[model samples]
Target: MKKEFAVIGLGRFGGSICRALSTEGMQVLAIDKDEEKVNEFKNIASHAVILDSTDEVSLKEIGISNFEHVIVAIGENIQASILTTVILSELGVQRITVKAQNDYHEKILNKIGAHQIVHPERDMGRRIAHNLISNNILDYLELSDEHSIVEVKAGRKMKGKTLIDLDIRANYGCNVVAIKQGKSINVSPMADEILKEDDVLIVIGADIDISRFEKNLVIDD
Candidate 1:
């Protein structure tokens, strides 16, 4: 069977993806134009190769089209990134996720048929900003442009309240999917379960609603 993923680049973003996928025991082919990078991941990925991904014939020789998902992570070089994404699209890679260096790069990638375009730096900036807003917000993940999932500490405002008493879903339009205290996580927490100051609530909803929910209970405290 073909590898499940192919990552074409060895920069911070691409290398991180390769490491995570490999750590998950997935079959990943790590490709890069730099020999040193290929050597670094030699034992990590299912296969590591030093090749110019922008060269169509080079990609075909390595059977790039066979991978179920291909990530174009050529760093800095917008030209190479666009060319590789275009070739991957033409080769009918089932899923092509490309890292956009900037807005212009994203637009060109979209025009050429990139299945998904990621702005890692931009997204990370948002995540950092959210975390900086208040110490109570432990983490944040963007589900979509308008939707997000946040892990926030239950502060003084929520310390003695129960899920139902707080009417989180009805009033805030956010769902408390889980609660964690210490190392224990309650994935299906009951509505009557009283919260503690140390509890961390994993909530998911529209970004605006989540912000409103946070402002009242988190920032207000």
Candidate 2:
């Protein structure tokens, strides 16, 4: 069955989620106090409404608590975001994800029982910075403050080299979890597996170790 989702605050983050969920065939209800924003998602989402999400009465009228998941993407107005999150928690919503503007806002959201807190701007900045620093790094996923998983394209140094010959784990303290060649993915790649120049390696390790591996192995040109 398709999960039901309600996205409050039809800003960039919320609107994007609404459209994505709708595209995946899930039911999405888009809400915002801005009439123009609400109307913008009318055709994209299952339903769209202009309402003040911070008001408990307004939320109850729209039956917000019935949705399986609710995303509060209120931008700038931290107070409104917190209030809306508090109401959703009190109403026993199954899951509530909120976009936090800062550390203090995130702390308040956590205390109010938000299921997940997203720092989209901060996370995206990190991803872009990592990509810029390493030309071979195709993508980066931050697992924690100290750890990350990165996808790096195999460079000339890695071409035709078997995993055992490279001894990557012992040398760099990073593990190659998978290798992607064109459309195929080899999960838990064998030690004898030869890496091709076009292969994409999915590696995981501590941030510092990953940096060392990228600098020593992955090349720009």
Candidate 3:
């Protein structure tokens, strides 16, 4: 069965999501206040509508609550985004994902019952900054404000040590979730799995613990 989704606001973020969901064979309803934006996605999405999302009456008339998931992607208008999210929550939409422009916006969205809040731009910036700051740190993802998942290149000190020998969970307060070598990855690696130089380790734990682990495991280059 195809999952139904409604994307509110046809800006770059919303439009891209609609196209991607449509490409994955989902039923996507794209909405926007601009007729041109709506028309632009006419052939891409299952349906496109031009309406003011802040207006609860208009939303109800269009049956916005019928969709399985609704995305509030209004970028410039924070008020509209918050109102739309509130309305969607009141209408009992199964899931509501909102694009937050900043920390303040994210707090508001969370308070209004948004299921997920995305800081796409901020996240991307953080990733880029991490890569720039440390050559060995391949990637970083924030699981929460405190926890994180990071991919770092295995150092010389780590080579030839099995998972049991390293005792990551016991010593570092983190787990080696995966090992990526060149073109291959071992997910949920066994306790006996050995670490090799140049291999990338995907570790998950609290941000402070992960940072400590990285500092101790990864050699500065």
Candidate 4:
């Protein structure tokens, strides 16, 4: 089954989403008030339209409600973004993800019923900072203010060590949810399995515990 998605506002963020979704073979409707932005995505998305998202009649005409997921990525125009979200919420869009410009904008988006709010610039900065701080960290996902899920690559200290020998759970209080070796992933890695070189461990736990784990095991002595 092909999943359907709609993205409103075709700036850098929305354009990226449009390309990524289309690349995955999903049906996407790209909408933007800017004609040039819409035209740019015509070949990339399933459908691209130039329309005012703030207008309720225009949104309904495009059948925006039919999409299971809709992203409000309107840039600069905070008023238009809010109005569009209100209409989407009233129309009962299943999932609404909005890009927030600031703290005040995020608060309004939350009150208007956005399912997910993304702070792109802030998030990217955090991710880069984490990668710079821990050389072995391949990826970092913030689950909450206090917790994160990180993909930590096996370093010299972790090579040939089993889960039990490392005592990851008891010592650092983090759980290895999966182990990735090349393209194959083991969701249920055994306790006695020896970690090989270049193995990526997907671990989830509190931020403090993850930091401790990195300090003790990931970095070189």
Candidate 5:
């Protein structure tokens, strides 16, 4: 069966998530307090409803807790977001993800047992910053505040070196988890495999370690 999902809010963040999930062949229930917002997503989501998510009775009526995953994307309204999360937790929802406005909002959501917390804007800003600072970094994904997975184009310095020669893990504390060349990806690449300038390395480690690796090998003068 397709995994079921519920997204509460029709703002950019929530709307984008709903669209992406639906595109992946998932059943998504989109909810927003505004009638217009709900109507906007009527055709995009499996079901779009205009309802106050803070009301536990309404959530129960709609069987929100039965979904495999629920995302609370309520914007600006911190109180409603917290209350909705609390209700979902009490109802024993399997997984609940929420977007936090700031640190304080995140703390409350954490205390209330939100399964995942997303700071989309802040994270995107950090990713953009990383990209701007380095030409070799193709992409960056934050696994946490201090750790990230990065895709970097192998530079001239790394072109002729093997994984063993680089000794990246031992020296930089980062792991080159995979190597992408043209259309193929080498998963768990062997230490003897030579790197090419055009190769893309998928590396994961602490931010500090990644920065060090990027500086020493991925960047060209």
Candidate 6:
């Protein structure tokens, strides 16, 4: 069954999501107050409307509650974002995802019953910074304030060493969740599986522990 989604705000983040979801064959209703923004997405989305999302009447008129998931991606206007989320919650929207500007915004959205909160800018900044600092670190994701998941290339020192021999969990307090070799991925790799020099390890642990493991694992040529 095809899922129905509503994306409000029509800013870069919201507009991109609407286009992507529509491309994936999901029914998407794109809403924005700006006529220009709505017109831009008219050809891409299932439906595009120019209206104030904070207005409960307008939301109801568009059948917003019928959507399986609704994304509030208002940028710059914190008040509008909060109000929209509150109205959606009150209307009994099945799932609501909100883009928050800061910690305070996230707290209010959470309190108002937002199902998910995304800090896209902060997450992207962290990922870019991590990639810039370490050449061996391919990617980084902040799972929480204290924990992270990272992808790091296996160093020469780690070549031909089985998971039991490395004992990453016992030594570095991190778990190797997956191994990426060429185009193939081995998720939940066995302890006896050997790692090659070019293998990429997807590891998850506390930030401090992950930092420690990265420093110890990567060696300059």
The lDDT leader among the candidates is: 5
Candidate 1 lands at a TM-score of 0.92
Top candidate when judged by TM-score against the true structure: 5
lDDT of 1 by residue, 1-221 (tens): 53599999999999999999999899999999899999999999999999999899999999989899999988999999988998998999999999999998988998998989899999999889988999999899988779999999998889899998899889989999999989999997999999999999999999999999989877744
Relative to the true structure, candidate 2 reaches a TM of 0.94
TM-score preference between candidates 3 and 6, better one = 6
Winner of 2 and 5 under lDDT: 5
**Residue 10 lDDT in candidate 5:** 89
In angstroms, the error of model 2 at 136 is 0.7
Model 3 — which ten-residue stretch has the worst lDDT? Answer: 212-221
Task: List model 5 lDDT by residue over 1-221, tens digit each.
Answer: 99999999989999999999999989999999999999999999999999999999999999997999999999999999999999999999999999999999999999998999999999899889878877888999999879999999988889999999999999999999999999999999999999998999999999999999988988787
Candidate 4 per-residue lDDT, tens place, 51-146, comes to 999889999998999999999999988999899999999999999999999999999999998999998888888889879986888888988779
Q: Residue by residue across 1-221, what tens digits does model 2's lDDT show?
A: 88999999888898888888999999999999999999899999999999998889989988988999999999999999999999999999999999999999998998999999989999999899988986788999888779999999998889999999889899999999999999999999999988899999999999999998898898655
lDDT of 6 by residue, 116-188 (tens): 9999999999999888877788999998889999998887768899989988899899999999999999999
| Superposed Cα RMSD, model 6 | 1.5
Q: Positional deviation of 217 in candidate 2, in angstroms?
A: 1.7
Better model by lDDT: candidate 1 vs candidate 3: 1
Q: lDDT value for candidate 3?
A: 0.90
After superposing candidate 2, which stretches have Cα over 4 Å from the reference? Answer: none
**Stretches > 4 Å off in candidate 6:** 219-221
Q: Please, what are the lDDT tens digits per residue for candidate 3 over residues 1-221?
A: 99999999888899899999999999999999999999999999999999999999999999988999999899889988999999999999999999999999999888989999998898889788778767788999988889989888877768899889889899889988889988999999889978888889999999888877877776464
lDDT of 4: 0.93
**Backbone clash tally (model 2):** 0
The list of candidate 1 runs beyond 4 A from truth reads 1-3
User: Which window of ten consecutive residues has the lowest lDDT sum in model 1?
Assistant: 212-221
